[model samples]
Target: MKKLIFLLLAFLAACTSTETKKATSGSAVIINETVVASAMERIKTSQPGVDQTLLEKGIRHAASLWREEDGNPSDFIEFVKANYISDPVRRKEIFTKISNYMESVNGHFNDITLDLKKNLDEAAGEIDQIDQMYGNYSVGSHLSDDFFSNKIAFAIALNFPYYPLAEKEKLGPGWSREEWAMARLGDLFVSRVPANLNQALNTALGNCDMYIAEYNICMGKLRNEEGKQLFPDDMVLLSHWNLRDELKANYANKENGIEKQEMIATVMERIINQDIPEVVINDPDYEWYPFSNKVMQNGKAIEAAREPDTRYDLIVKTFRAMKDIDPYNPEMNTAMMRKFSWEMEISQEE
Candidate 1:
């Protein structure tokens, strides 16, 4: 589930508006350093005694992310003045409202997906290729586009600026829930991923998920050295989670437990390594012997080539597509790091 969610949102930062990078840290800024410095000075001069340090930080941070679509320096300054909530109480109130709205939207979208794709997702009925494709389609791909177009993204960035993982780690322990929520809100607009790339990512992930869904190991057709079936006729395990879980479940049956576990492990390794034969996967027509590395059909040994590294290829595809967004996300560049440290709130060391 986390993997699926990451597939959806991790690419979101890459799908920003076509406003182009103006004041990004690396790029030669259209809104140059001088322009930004002047804007900050103006804000500071205009709003005296308004947490000068925070005001400076917010202005600079927002300027760094500001694009051509977000308006010029004067417009940026005015937006900063209007939207930057100075009072902690008022800021918290706004954050709470936004948080509640976000929760509601997310919850409803989740429910809609679950309900709409019940046939394909829940394994309830015969789902064709079309059904599968439709089920895997993303619902929230355009969310970033909409938010940024409406200046909601700018508003959030101006008020609750982002903190990198390192900073969060150092300061997070003492932070209240609202402060943490503010940090999370800051997390959204850190980078903008193009919508097309996000669509590609969604398509790639959806295909991988569909492949996994159809990848079932017929347990009853699995044979050992003596050509004896170890599992019940109706038993089937989906790769690789269910198959792995079945392997773990055999621990109590000491008689053949280790052997069964070893066989399942071997199957998993073959799948992961892309050595599993194309004919035996999800097809009960062929009985497979993991130990002997053979496939038998109609009780006769037949030659079949190994799978074309589709499983491993998808993993690579996912990583490559995700890695494309690393440059955009300065804090948690890699998707794995983002998943663990940012989204799951678990540090790498932990």
Candidate 2:
């Protein structure tokens, strides 16, 4: 028994060692969660403090999209990378396809939102119709809320790498159950993100929850609850291994920076001012919120957009603030710039 136990321990040690070797040799580190975690690690360990600013911005957007949707981080990462194929022509083709797909989903979502709002409005004005839609206390609004949960969420599961023609034909057009899935998949083909994926995500902004939910279900990455419960659907898990905490931490910093930029700026101001009263505000002990850089306009930077209308719009938005900053600046060629804008806008009609 002692001899057998010694042999078994040796066997287990060898197997564990082999597994670790295989992982280090073959694994690729990637994910929405992983991106955040890895980014934070790089920032933390930088020998000379690498600029993590871009990573932060990208991760913030990723977190918003990730938190509000459902799908495997792996699948999403795959989709993002694959669509960025090197061949320019092929890249354009894939992007255009994704763009149209997004348009279809967006249009559908908009129509649904408008129709529901109208129905609720009518019900509110009429007690008779109220029974039809508003019978249960605020059930009418609840129905709309449920619709958002179901329909308005982003569903980005795609099926774009062409399967064989035979496989395509297996999905024959019909009024059968399998055909229903085929029809839904057909919409997937139609919703292409134009030119690039960021645009596609923008286009799919208000729709595609079903696709996102379905992808999560397939990858077994579904969260128990999130968003407005925007994504809820059946999914299958193909493999095991989860997004690392370090990655998620990267995105967490991103989230904090984006929503709290003003606060960060205000802290910097107080630290610079060094006044006793401001010290209370500056106390890093409290959630030291400095006025964010969002409000602090850059005079030189604003002047550098190289287009009058762009400058005009900036001036218009921060007119009160900009006026104070550059009081000596002469009036811009408002008429010529507007003409230049009109002509440039008209040129696009071609």
Candidate 3:
């Protein structure tokens, strides 16, 4: 039976892996090599003494992001011709303007997000279902689509092409402040993840956050094997960070320190195994004995059901949400790859 179960699990794993690869493999490359080549040649011919390397990289990167909705080959060619800055002074001026504009746009978006998340993140007041919905709504979710529609993204991509982490590490030392800023600016608009997917991802993560925020263990209601309360009546701790911290702090309590740590360890184990009583979480009305896995209420023992794998369910939902975004990001298709290569500027192999 165990062998058969193992084989079944392996089959499922293979199926999931195959699905992920299939999803990511279909990232549409609409702009063919011929279009890219023609666009580069036309721009170079039109503007004499232009930087050959920049011209090639910028045009190719812009072409990689262009879609049918953006326009035809001729339209792309015209855009490159019109937007590619050849003169050093003119390029700097344009860079400054774009930088300022992006700063303002990003700043306002951040302000809006903070305001939206105020009730969720803080202990200001009671959070309703509407508050959760508002918190999950991402104001900047459609920003990428809007930028693409306005041709601002294309303009930025044409002027400032993205550099991979390895390339940036190699060329970073000699670059001036302005050049560094331009390279950073080029990092935007590399992917075209849809707004709906972005919102879904946000909601999934927000739900997880809310679950964690509400996961408080009433320490005051905990009892040891002898039915003795070790903690104060008002003590409460949130798992798993606060619980771990409390365990660490208890090491200094020479008296019953090991006992407290053992109880805390038992609580953590129960949480991980999903054997924690659902009623005991965030409820001070019940007394829980971690060592015996028993619960009592109103001075009498009572029956309670264990948590029904809600923690693991939330985790799987978040993972699938992140995976849904993989197709839009052709270069860093996986969330792990994006975290290491794009966000952290470090390759996964390292």
| Estimated TM-score for each candidate | 0.85, 0.21, 0.91
What tens digits encode model 1's per-residue C-alpha lDDT throughout 14-121?
Answer: 554333242143322245677767766676677565777666666666776666766777787677777877788888899988889889988988987787578767
- Name the weakest run of 10 consecutive residues (lDDT summed) in model 1: 20-29
| Candidate 1 error regions (>4 Å) | 1-32
Question: What TM-score would candidate 3 get against the native?
Answer: 0.91
Q: What is the C-alpha lDDT of each candidate?
A: 0.76, 0.31, 0.87
Q: Per-residue lDDT tens digits of candidate 2, residues 50-87?
A: 33543343333333333223345654444333322334
Instruction: Report the CA-based lDDT of candidate 1 relative to the real structure.
Output: 0.76
Predicted model with the maximum TM-score: 3
Off by over 4 Å in 3: 1-26
Best by lDDT: 3
**Residue lDDT tens for model 3, 139-213:** 999999899889999999988989988889899998999889999999997787878778889999999989988
Ranking by TM-score: 3, 1, 2
Clashes of each: 8, 31, 0
